[model samples]
Target: MRVRMTGLAGVIAIAALLVGAAPASAAPGDASAYGARLDVTLLGNPAVHAEPFAAANANGPTQNTFVGVDLPGILKTGVINASASRDDKSGGVYSRASTADVRVDLLSKVTGKISAELVEAECAATQKGLVGKSKLAGVNLGKLGQVNADPAPNTVLNVELAGIKIAEVIFNEQYKNNDGSLTVNAIHVKLLQGKLGSLGTGDVILSSATCGPAGLPIPMASGAGLWIGLGLLGVVAAPVAFVALRRRAALNAA
Candidate 1:
């Protein structure tokens, strides 16, 4: 009886290992629409896209931040704002978005400027992307409004981020599993809007991505080679599974 019990224990242990070792989904699956909760920073040039908007413009620093909160990727909400300086070398232009709540899809991607069309789709999609609540700050005019310029000698311009241009994005792709843990994947963005700006008005490319959720780091991937790199992660996780099973069984017996 003792020998039989030992054999049965081994079988159970192996079974547990297999179950625990079941592979991560091939894609995000139903949860693909969401991503791990994280704060994000986007940086790019704004002057390049300011062609028809401003003749000879230069963009200082283009940045946008996505605030993280406690929720699933699809139902998640966040405060997002961006700022940039566009100057025709004579006048100054600045941009701002008053703090507002927007529905977010952490795993999704935005290509060109965040146009009315894009905003509508995300907010309207079944797994909505961005659900903007209300306008935060009143739109600040850069050239039309006579505002104080920064250290630079130019017209003060403030444009609300009603539409934004994006060349690339580095965002977390989160997948919430039945186990409750999130599987994160970083995507190094690549797109066509690199040469565009907000409302096709700014002179730079706008980029956005997620930053946190404590741990679980996944690298950004842009091409075929990215897959090859990700494949190795599964191999690395195998041994860790065995150790986890042993610890669980020991605790149960005790």
Candidate 2:
């Protein structure tokens, strides 16, 4: 009986060591975001092409801000802000972007003006938290049509010049990247026509965000807990075995 109890204790101790040596859980996903990205041309001349402020894979909170920019009669902006952050607690990521005071004069025919406010975009691990918000104050799109404040993903607003389609305004643009990441753009302007009567063609983006895939769930008893429990069992068995051996020795002596 004592030998059997000793063997059981050994087995329990070995199992505890194995459980403690198991590999750890996978790490959380990465995150990336930008305030504004512009790739445009005026009569084949590069106007504004750059991503002014951006962040990626930061362990903590990160942010950036820009005063204003201009393309002289083509496009103009005021006060751009962007931010990105990660939550180690929930293994989730988040990002946001916003712009203010925007004006776009395309060939002086199809003009757009937004007063003191522009757009914002947010991204997170969950679908409910991923959204695009438009704060287009005093918006006036001359001959282009109305702007949707809360536009769905890939919502397109056609641009026409003299009853002919010339360009398009895409809102809440979202893409599921090949690597399972999600990208959200608050606003995207694409000039389809090569030249809208000498204006030229290009693309413009505002308030962009992206986040990597969700992390796998972690299980309980996958770490030290399992080892500790088995260790306690081994301790109890050792004392029980010692007691059994002492009693057997006394009986043999008698």
Candidate 3:
């Protein structure tokens, strides 16, 4: 008996194999497997709260209880490992061990949701208590889009502040968890002096702040490169395999 397969069938088989080998997209919270953090600066005196532990603690996770915040103008080592450019005179390089997704929630009647990539987060005790702050200077608002207000998701808040820096942004002790990582509860955004779209700005205030759940771990660069190489090889080999198989079948039949 001769074994035979058509060109189309061979192509499909190869495609199936590649798809099976590919990894699933990292979901929210997958990135925070090690830990997570959130930093926010608001323009209001309103008090807010968040329950970041609620999701992990609903069933009680085995993760440790360590938390911190990132403040502006502070030189933290090895926190943000992206293509961030810093003009520090000391000349130090920062490399991240891994990246994670982090969410911040503004707990109040009217809420505001904010989140950022947890590329670098350091939690430690201070005279005031635990303070963790990360650098968020180069973040592109276009990627983040207009900040949305809760309940009325359609209402996207607009800010026209140029060279905007998430300054004076520090995570205070209000955020705490006994069995999990710290989640940002509330933030106070002081206008300092800026404009809010049409609302001519002298003083802008934030009612509450909130964060979405953490996202999954980003794909490893090495792994992705390997998969690409394999996929290309499969594409080139599929046609050759089909032709060879067809010739073999014809020879056997003859």
Candidate 4:
């Protein structure tokens, strides 16, 4: 009985190893499957896409014990886990639904200009691939009005840095959520290239990717390769089976 039980346990272990050997559909507690994905390509004299993400979520540091919550401090709030990404082949922009409640507070005091200049400076120095004249511009998404916290104050703001233009981009959304997590979705950002005079006039690309969940690190493709290898084994085995079957038939005919 003991020996039989040991053999059964060995079989189960082997099966578990096989299933776990590749990136299977994420199990429960694992992030839900990556939802929909979007991609875009454009052409013209000014070739580029400024696609915006639909809806999404992001994070940050401990709220100040007493300062009135404002945009600059909120900007400092870091996203612990972001479902943000960008890719030429896979997607242009993406957003996760805000999980917490939201009530955006529009503040007239905050000017997007400071953030715009700051971003442009950073890009000119580090983003070699992004060459251009760019600056921030606001799209009149009129009547966004004052944002407020829902249920009274927790909401999530998901922002992906990947999809932003290198030269300059402006954020005008003023927000607050019931749970303290506020989310901002697709916003119009201007693009530019070459010289300062030429900024916000032509070609640029924008994009984002859905990050899985908070706390978990972004998943690498190593597991994807493992699954691909398993699939290739299936293809190779099919040919070997065909050859073996042909041999058996030939002998029987003989």
Q: Which candidate number maximizes TM-score?
A: 2
Q: What is the C-alpha lDDT of each candidate?
A: 0.28, 0.65, 0.31, 0.26
| lDDT tens readout by residue for model 1, 1-254 | 44345556655665554444333211121111121223232343222211111111113234444553333322233343433333322122223322233333322333212211011000010121211111212222222232221111111222323354333332222333454323322222233333444222112211111111121122223243346444544554555556556666776798
Give the TM-score (vs. native) of candidate 1.
Answer: 0.19
Q: Sort the candidates on lDDT, descending order.
A: 2, 3, 1, 4
Tell me model 3's lDDT, rounded to 2 decimals. 0.31
Estimate the Cα RMSD of every predicted model relative to the unseen true structure: 20.8, 7.6, 17.7, 17.6
Which candidate would rank higher by TM-score, 3 or 4?
3
Superpose all Cα atoms of candidate 2 onto the true structure and report the RMSD in Å to 1 decimal.
7.6
Off by over 4 Å in 3: 1-5, 25-29, 33-50, 53-243, 246-253
Segments in model 4 whose C-alpha atoms lie over 4 Å from true places: 20-210, 213-254
- Give me the displacement of residue 213 in model 4, in angstroms: 4.1
Tens-place lDDT digits, model 4, residues 1-254: 44345445555654565566433422111111011112222213333332222222222110111111122211211111124223312212222221111111121122221221111100111111211121122222222222221112222222122453323322322233343222332222333333333323432111112222222122222455556655655665555556556666776798
Candidate 3 lDDT tens digits, 1-254: 22335555666776665555444432222112223232323444332222222122211242233333233221111221211111122111111112233333322112233444433332323123333333332222333253221112112232233444322222221244543333332222222334332211122111111122222233312355456647676776767687878788788798
Per-residue lDDT over 5-66 for candidate 2, one digit per residue giving the tens place of the 0 to 100 score: 66677667656654554334335556666666677776657566765554433454477777
TM-score of each: 0.19, 0.67, 0.23, 0.22
CA lDDT, candidate 4, residue 64: 12
Candidates 3 and 4 compared: the better one by lDDT is 3
